[model samples]
Target: MFVSKRTFSTYRALFHENPLGLPRHKPAPTIPRAHRGLPKKMPIAGVKNVVVVASGKGGVGKSTTAVNIALAAAGLKRRVGILDADIFGPSVPKLMNLKGEPELTEKGDRLIPLTNYGVKCMSMGFLVDQDAPVVWRGLMVMKALQQLLHQVDWGQLDLLVIDMPPGTGDVQLTISQQIVVDGAVIISTPQDIALIDAVKGVNMFKKVNVPILGMVQNMSLFICPNCQHESHIFGHDGAARMAEEFNVPLLGQVPLHADICTLSDSGKPIVISQPDSPFSNYYRSITQNMLNRLQEIK
Candidate 1:
C-alpha cells in the first residue's frame, strides 16, 4: 500500500518486459532491399515512430513543444521517449526534470534512459555539467550523437520524439540520413524572421524526404488577463499561411501564456502539470491530430 513510485516502476519494468505492450516481443519488420539504399535509414531496435521536432533557429519554444508533445502522447497510454539532440544546448534534462548520468544495463554496454512523468529521456545534458560548454568539432559532435542514438537501451517505445537542434546543421543531417524518421514537426513563432528560418527547415526536411507532419505556430496569440483582450503579439497566421503555401497541415497553435513559461521553467510541462487547463488541451489536440495523421499515412 505504501510502495514507492520508483520501486513500483522498477518492478513493472522487470515484470512487464514488453515495453510496447505487444502480445509477444518480435523483431521489427526488415526494410525491403529496394528501400535499403535510399539514404540508408537505420531503424532503432525497439522504436516504431521517430518524430523530430525542429525549428529554423533557436528560442522559438521548439524544445518546450517537444517535451509537452511527448508527455501528451504518454498520457494517451503509449510508451514514449524523448532524445535531446541539441548537444550544445541540451534542454531535455531541465524540461524533463532529470539529471545525472544514466545507469548502465546489466551487461554494461548500453545506457538506460532516465524516466520522468511516464516518459523515458536521454540527452547530453546528463553526461556533462550543466554549465559546461560543448566545444567539440563536427566529427566529435556526430560521434556523440551516434552514441546517444544507438547506445541507449530505449526498450519498446511507440514513439521516440527527438528535440533536434535548430537550423540545418550537421546533427540534423546525421539524424535524417541515419535514422528512419517517420515524420517531422516544424515549430516557429509568428514573426517574419522566425518564419523565414522555419521555411529553411521545411525545405531541408523536404530535401531529405522526411515527411512533414505539420507546422505548429507557437506564441501565436496572447490574451490579456485583465481585459480578456486578445493580441497577436508576434503577428498572426504566419505559420498557417506558410503551411498553406507549402502544402503542409497547420497542426495547432499555442498561445503565449505566463503559466506555460513558468511551468516549463519548473520542469513541469503544462500537459502534465495542468492537464485540465486550456493550454494542455491545445497540446493534447495536437498530439491527437498527429496520431491520426500517422495512422492515415500508415
Candidate 2:
C-alpha cells in the first residue's frame, strides 16, 4: 500500500513537530517477483543444452575427461563450447592451449571465446593472472558465472560443456538450479572412496530431475607401452558395476594414459594432437553412445 498525497502532508507535519531528526517515510523500493535468500551458490541463465560434467570428488581426471569429450563432440562437425565453471581449479585454458584473454567485440557485449582444437573455450584463468588465487565469496562467484553466461556471445552451439566443481555443495546447486541443463555425465575413478562420492553426485542430479547420461570410468586400467600388458590399477569395471547398481548406463572406460595427462596439462588435447591414439578412440566411442542415448530419450 502506498501513502496518498493528502496523507503525506500529515506525516511531514508530525515529524516537524517532533524535531528529533526523524524524517517522513517514503515508498519502498521495487519488490522482485521471486523472493531470494542468501545462497552459497548463484543461479545463472541463457544457455542451451548445457551438459554438466560432474564427479563425486577431485583428482579423478574429471577436467581432462571433460576437455576430451568436448573435443570429440566438435569432431562431429557440431558447434561446441565449454564453460570452465570450476572456481577452485580451472584447467580448460591450459588444456586446450588457449592463450590470451577473451576479446571483447565492439558490436554486441558478447565475449568472444578463444578457440583451440576447433572448440570454443572459456575459463577463469583467462580473466585473472595464472598464479592469482580466486578468493571470492559465493555472491562474487555467482556474479562471475552470470557474466560468463550472458556477457559471452556463444553464438549458436549444439552443446555447451560445463565442467562443474568437484562436489555436491553450493556451486553445484547454483549451476543445477539456475541453468536448464539437458543431462549430466558422472566421472569416477575405480575406487571405493571416489565411487561413494560419485553415487552422491548422481543422486544430487536425480533430486533436481536432471537425467544421467551415464557414468564414465577413468583410470580403469593402465597399459605399459614397454610390455603392452594391461593392469587393473584401481580395479576393473568398478564404474560399470556402480552404473548397473544405480540403473544408469556405463558410457565408457578410459585407461590411465600418461600422455593424456601430460598433453592436457601442457594445453594440447590428445584428441587433436594424436587423433589415432587409443585414448582418443575411447572418447570418440563415448560421444557416439551419448548420441544414441539422446535419440532413445527423444
Candidate 3:
C-alpha cells in the first residue's frame, strides 16, 4: 500500500475541489468588511487647545521645540502644559529636569502633572526607571498612552503641547483618532533626508484632518561660538522650499547652537535660560507664529 503526506494547504485544496477533474462547487467568495467610521474625538477636560509637535524623523529638535514653545507661551502669561506622548522615549522629564512619580489628586483619581519653570508637564520618564527600556509590544504601549492622556489632571491650561514620538506610528494615530487635535507643528532639519520625512508628517496630519499650523526649520544653521560665523551644516533652504511647496507657513528657523543644547540638557531650555539671546528669540518667534495659525484655524 502506498502512503502519501499532505500539508494544510493541500488538505484545504482537496476539500475545495476534486483532484480527479470531477465537477465540484466553487468556494464562496469572502465579502469585504465594512469600514468603521472615524472614532469620536474627546477633548481633554481643562485644555483649551491641543497642539502636537511632530516630526517625520527623529533627532530633529522636535522635543526641544515642544518644550521651548510651551515655555514661550507661558512666558506670555498663557497657561500651558507639555505632554510627552513619546512612550518608548520620553524626553520631557530630562528636558524639564523633573523626576519622581506623580502624586494623586485630592480625589485620589487622577495623577497631578509636575510643574517647573511655570509650566505643567507629564511624561512616561517620570514613572519608570531612567535606564530601563520599554521592551513591550504595541498593545501594551497603547494602554500606557490611554492612562497618560486621560488620567493626568492638568488643572486649567490655555494650551496643551503634546511632544509626539517621531514618525507616523501608533501613538500618533491613536492621538489623532482619539482626541480633538487643534493643530500640528511639524519640525525638520534643513537636510534632504529629514525633509523627506517631514513631508510625510505634514501629509499624515492633513489626511487626519488636523490643521497644519506650520513647519519649524531646526538646525537650519550652526553658529560658531568662538567666531560669529553662520554655517549651513545640514544644507540650506531645504525646509523653506518644502514649506512653500506644501503651502504651509514657515514658522521660524532655529540655528544649531551650543547653549540651546546645554541649557536643554540641564532642564533649563533656552527660552527661559537666556530669554534675551537670539536663540531664545527664534523660539519665541515660532511660538507667536503658532498662536497666530491657531487663531486663523479657529
Candidate 4:
C-alpha cells in the first residue's frame, strides 16, 4: 500500500512538486479571523536556524516529539528555545514543566524566555490560563506567533523549534509564507489515514519552498512490557517508503515506549531522565542527525 502511494507521488511529481497534494477533506480550511493583521517580521540574531515540527493532522505525538527533540538539543550543550506555536493547544509548558511567565530582562522592556533543562522556553499557556479556551481568531494567532519570534529576546546559539499547530491551516500557511523556515520535520504514524495527512504536511512545506529535513515515524513499533516482544501496532516502514518516494531523509523511528509517556507527563523526558534508556538514545541519535543536517543546510 505504501509503495503504491509513493509511486503515484513520484509520477505526479512531474506535474508539480506538490509535497502535500490535497488534504483528505478536499480543500484545507483556514481559521476565521475578524481582522488580518500583518505579523511582526523579525529574526532573532545569533539564532542559527528555525526548525518546525509539524504534521498533517493532530494527535500523532507532534508536540511530544517537538518537546523531546528540543530537550535533546539542549543535552548537546547548546542554547535552544521552543516556540509553542500551537496556540490552541499549547503543551510545551506542561511537557517540560516550564512554569511561570517569561521574566523581563533589565534591557528596557525586553522579555526573556523562561529556561528549563538548559533550554529557553516560551508558550501561550504561560501568558494566560492553560485550560481556558484560546478564543483566538486567525489574525490574532498570527500576531501572537510573530510577537513570540520578535518581542522576546531569544539569546544566542543553536536552533529554535516551532511546534506548529496541526494541519495546513491559515496560521501554518502564514508562518511558512512569512517566516524563513530553515527546514521542517513531519511526524506521522504508520497508518493510511495518518500518512495521507502526513503527505499533505510534507507537501505544504514543499509548496512554500521550505526544506524538508525528513519524515519521523512516531509509534513505529510497540514493545510488549511483560514479554519484551515487538509488535507492529500501526504497521511498518510506511514512513521509510514515503521518505524514499520523496527523496527526503528518514531521520529515525521512535517506538511506543511506556517510559516515554510516564516520564514525559511527569516533566521528565526520557532523554533527560533516563539517558541510558533505548528510547532516549534513539532521540539523541535523531537529534545528532538533525544537527548535522542543520550544519549542512547552512
Candidate 5:
C-alpha cells in the first residue's frame, strides 16, 4: 500500500513521539516497609486451645475422626466445640446432624454456634443449603474462613477442633498464618498413597510453626465380623512408621468398621451412638493423647 505524503508525515510524527510505539515503563508499586511484616496471629476469643485436624488428600476419614474426637473430648467432661473449615465441602453439619443458619449474638457482631450431643458445632454448611455448592474464588473463601475463625461466640471452651479442608492450599496457609493453633492432628489411612500426603500436611504445620500433636491411623484393620479374623486392610502400622520418622507421637489407630461409617452418615457418630463400643473407645484414646500433647505444648 502506498501512503500519501500527509499520512507518511503523521506516521513519522507518531514514531518521533514514541520510537518503540510502546507505553513508557512505570515503576512497580511497593508496600510500606512497616506494613510488610507478617500478620500477627490472633487467638480465638473464649477458646482456650485450638487443634486442627488435617489430611493430605480427600477420602481419608479425617472429618469422621475429627467429629469423634470432639465427641470423645466432650464425653471426658471437657467443653468441646468443632469448626468445619472445609467451606467447599463442609461435613460438620451432616456429621453433627445440625441444620439451619447460626443466630447472631446479642451484639450482632458474632455467630452463635449450634450445639448437639453436648458439643457445640459450626460450619459453612449451616450458613448455606446442604445441597448447594460454594462456588467462590480464593478471596471469598479466605473471607469466609476469617469469619469462621474469629466471629463465633464459642462460650469458653476448653478445646476447639478445626476440621481443615484437604490438601495444602490457600485455606491451609491462611489459617496457619492467622490463628495461634495449639496443635495439629494429622489423619490418614494406612497406605503409602495417603501417608505421602500426610507427610506434606505435617511439613506444612511445621513450616507455620504449629505443633504436630501426632498422627492417627484410620482404617488400619478390618475385623471380619463373622470369622473373628483381623485383616490389615490398607497396611499395618503405616502411620506408626510415619510418626516415628517424623518424631511425633502415634496417637492411636481406628479400625475400619462399617458401623463407624453408618453411624456417622446417620448423624450419630460412634462415640455418641455407642459410647461403650470399642470404636468409641479408640476415639476417646486419641482425644486423651491429643489433650496430653496439648498440655505438653502449653
Candidate 6:
C-alpha cells in the first residue's frame, strides 16, 4: 500500500512537533530469571512478533533495510520497535539519528528505549562510546545479545524488528535458540557473491526452524537522476532465481539510489525523508508484502 501525501504530511508534522528526547518513565526492573540451560525459545515480554532482518555478509545494506522496514511499519500505524542485534557493529543508532546512553527507568533497573521517527529503538551503539571498538569474544557477544533481547523495555509493540549481525554464527544461533523469532527477512544484493552468502543465511535459519518471510534484493538497479536511464549494475533477477530455487518469495527489489545513501548517512532514512519518492514507495511495498506474509503465517 502506498502512503498518501496527506498521511506523509501528518507524519512529518507529528514528528516535528513531538521531537525526540522523550521523558523517561519509572518502572520496576522486569528482567526474566535465568534458566539452567538454554530452552528451545523464549518470548519477549511485550513484543507480539519478533521479526529479524539478516544478511549473509556485511556491506549489503542490511542495516539500512532493517531501519527502513521499521520506519515503514511505523508509518503504517503499527506499534513498532527496533532492536540492534549487531553487537559487533550496531548501526541502528546512526540510521535512526539517535545517540547517547539510554536512561534507566525510574526503578533504576530497566533500560528505557530511545525513540526516533516514532519508532522505539535499542542498540549496542548507544551503550558504548562510538569510537571504542567492540572487541569481545564469542561468549561475551552471546551474553550481550541475551541482555539486548530480554532487558530493554520495548513496551507493547505489535512488531519488533531486529537488525541482526551479518552471517550465521554464535549470535544468530543464540537468538534463534534462545529468543522466539516470529520470522526472518533476508537482505542481499543481486550479485552472485552476495547471493552465495545469502544462501548460507537461508540454510542456517532453516536448520533452526525459523520461518523465512522472504528475501529483499537491495541495490538491484541504478537510475541516473538527470538522464532517468535505468541500469542493472548488479546482475538482475539473481535474487528472483535464487528465491525460486529456495522456494522463498522475492519480497521486493530496492534500486540503488544516491538519495537513499545520503539521507541514511545524514540520519534521516529515505522512507521518512522522502516518503513521496518512488524509492520510499518501494520500501513501503516491501514492508506491506512482509506484513502480508506475516498474516499468512499467523
Over 1-298, each residue of candidate 4 has an lDDT whose tens digit, in order, gives 1221222122223322221121122222233443875443335666788999998889888988988899898889877888888778888898888876555544323346778888888887776656678675656666556555555668885889999888898768777765668999989898778999999998889987789988889999998878889998888888888989999888898999788888888988888899888998888888888788777877
Q: State the C-alpha lDDT per candidate.
A: 0.84, 0.76, 0.84, 0.76, 0.84, 0.83
Kindly report which residue pairs in candidate 6 clash with one another. Answer: 26-106
Candidate 6 residue lDDT tens string, 1-298: 2221121122223322221112223221222445655565779889989999999899999999999999999999999999998887889989999987776554433457889999999987887778878787665565556667766778899999999998888789888888889899999999999999999999999999999999999999988888878999888878888999999989999999889999999999999999999999999999999999998988
- Candidates in order: C-alpha RMSD to true structure: 8.0, 11.9, 14.6, 13.9, 14.8, 9.6
Those runs of model 3 whose alpha carbons end farther than 4 Å from true positions after fitting are: 1-36
> Per-candidate TM vs. native?
0.87, 0.83, 0.88, 0.84, 0.87, 0.87
List model 2 lDDT by residue over 134-154, tens digit each.
786766666556556555657
Query: What's the CA error at residue 118 for candidate 4, in Å?
Result: 0.5
lDDT of 5: 0.84
Off by over 4 Å in 4: 1-42
RMSD of 5: 14.8
Indicate the residue-level lDDT of 275 in model 4: 87
Expressed as tens digits, the lDDT of each residue in 1-298 for candidate 1 is 2222221123224322322111122332222345456445789989999999999799999999999999999999999999999999999999998987676665544668899999999988876678979777766676667667777789999999999999898889888888899999999999999999999999999999899999999999997767767899899899999999999888999998888999999999999999999999999999988888777777
Residue 131's C-alpha lDDT in candidate 3?
Answer: 98
**Over the stretch 99-208, how does candidate 5's per-residue lDDT look in tens digits?**
87676654444667889999999888876667878787776676667767777779999999999999999889878888889999999998999999999999999999
Task: Report the C-alpha lDDT of model 3 over 67-167, residue by residue, as the tens digit.
Answer: 99999999989999999999889999999999876766544445678899999999888766799787767766776676677767799999999999998
Error of 5 at 242 (Å): 0.5
Candidate 5 has which clashing residue pairs, if any? none
lDDT of 4 at 81: 88
